[model samples]
Target: NKQIIDATIDYTVAYKPNIAFYETQGSKGWDSLQKTIEYIPKECFTIADAKRGDIGNTSAMYARAFFENMSFDSITVAPYMGRDSVKPFLQFEGKWVILLAYTSNSGSNDFQKLKIDNTPLYEQVIATSSQWAGDDKLMYVVGATHPEEMANIRSLVPNNFLLVPGVGAQGGSLKEVSAAALTKDVGLLVNSSRGIIYASNDIDFAKEASQKAKEIQQEMMGYLDLLC
Candidate 1:
């Protein structure tokens, strides 16, 4: 995060801390995350990739922790728990609820691709979710692996930004995703977590990481040009 903050002059936008990466280390991990986030520039987006999906009031408090307390700009939410469980997060303005639509993980097919009421589960997720919130407040997690589906999802809700992951190490094609997902405002945020951040184990790791970021940014620049 400090590297991205200090190292790059580009409009890098956001930094996400996947909670599992921190939680696996216990309390110290959580503390480190807090410290890391604190150092992030106010201009850059900060996201808690907690993927928190709980029920009732329990869901509300989790929303407060990330949105109210941590002051994160956006959060990833799982809709399987139902819209009620996810709606509490939508109450914040200028904050985004990145609802999981179709993910890149190999096991996602077990449920996401399954048919329900004659519609694919992911399509149903997009259809049902489009009703709960407008595009400005709600974004969807459409994995880069399913770039072809992005256009279909957009046809459902054209104005929303799609927080796309799996572009780098996961072999998701950025070119294809951008082709299907780009909005007039350059809507897709193609995340390259492990591929960029963990690029090297050598002492000058941050420099190597920046190189990876530069590569992605150039590709994004091309997409931005497409918007123009």
Candidate 2:
């Protein structure tokens, strides 16, 4: 958030600023984050990557804080607290909830891949959460790093948009992720954080970032054409 003022000018439908990155630095960090997000174009979606995990009225307040006060277009939420906890965020029109289904980190396997009854936990998340709202109101975070399982998720919620992470620095296979997770509506927002945004450490960082973003976007355009 400190460096990427022009980052949103690149090819992306949205820019997600995970709260953890800013909060770790305390109140001053929070102020910087708000200012940084305020710089993003209104046409581009801005997500508060809070992954907030709480219940009921408390969750509602969190929703209010991000969507009402912070004024974000979307938020990342953990659905473990069930429908009641997750529904508050969906109450606002033009706002989306990108629920965490599968994540990029190795520790994700600790719970996300677990089997309950017969289906994998991630599969269950897709199924249950799809029932909460229609595709336009909700999306999911299915990491690009998990290509083998990507196909399964696509089958589960075919229409909703997916915010994918871990494509570049994490060694995720973009080809496979695109093949498995794409929808005809250009629903895959593949995120390359360190790969593009931090592409250069020198003075030419933003230029390099834009170049990398364009390269990825061109690939998206190609996929879009093929899918059409």
Candidate 3:
């Protein structure tokens, strides 16, 4: 894990640790996660993929745990409970709230695509939650699996950042997503989990991971230049 962090310093812009994986190991896992966050380069953003949401008071404690205790730069949030569930995370200055809009999971179609007032719920989530904070403090989770919908999402919230997953092992095309979603801010944080970190299980794992991350970073550069 340390090797991967060291290897990715130059090739990636952020590191996200899915909290469930850590919580399973109890205190050891929590310790490892904290150390990992510390090891990450200051220039790169750190995200806690906790997907937490609840009533106002409970949500406030979660905000404190992640934003104040662990000190993550941003966190992934489930916006099902409306403004109260999400507002606590947005209260922290310089920290960000990445609301789940359209997830990449197979079951996402269950409700995220349901139409409300003639618009998809995911679209409404983006449109409404974006009003909570400016682009700097709020982002949306738009999975790469929905490349077809990328353009429309961009149209809805053009200025906000997007924490996109489903690339690499998930069969999401970075090239296609970039074409549909790239904004003036280059507003996409494309994530490749198993595809990069597990590129090889051998002793050369870190080397292979670095190579995979560099490949993605280099590809993103061309698209970024297009905006210039």
CA-only RMSD, every prediction:
1.5, 1.6, 1.0
Alpha-carbon runs more than 4 Å astray in model 2: 1-3
Candidate 1, poorest ten consecutive residues by summed lDDT: 2-11
TM-score, prediction 3: 0.97
lDDT of 2 by residue, 1-228 (tens): 544647537577778887998999999988988888788888888889899968889999999999988899899999998999998898999889999999998889999999999778988988988999999989899888899999888888888888899888998877889889887764787888788877899998888888888888888778778787
Give candidate 1 misplaced runs (Cα > 4 Å): 8-11
Quick one: best TM-score, which candidate?
3
What TM-score fits each model?
0.94, 0.94, 0.97
Q: For residues 79-149, what per-residue lDDT tens digits would candidate 1 score against the true structure?
A: 99898899889888889899999998988899999998888999999999889998788888888888777
- Cα lDDT tens digits, model 3, 1-228, are 789988877888899999999999999999999998888878889999999999999999999999999889999999999999999998999999999999988898999999988999999999889888899899899999999999999999878889999999988999999999997664799999989999999999999999999999999998988898
Question: Which rank order by lDDT, best down to worst?
Answer: 3, 2, 1
Worst 10-residue lDDT window for candidate 2 reads 1-10
Which model, 1 or 2, shows the larger lDDT?
2
**Residue 109 of model 3: what lDDT?**
93
Segments of candidate 3 deviating more than 4 angstroms: none
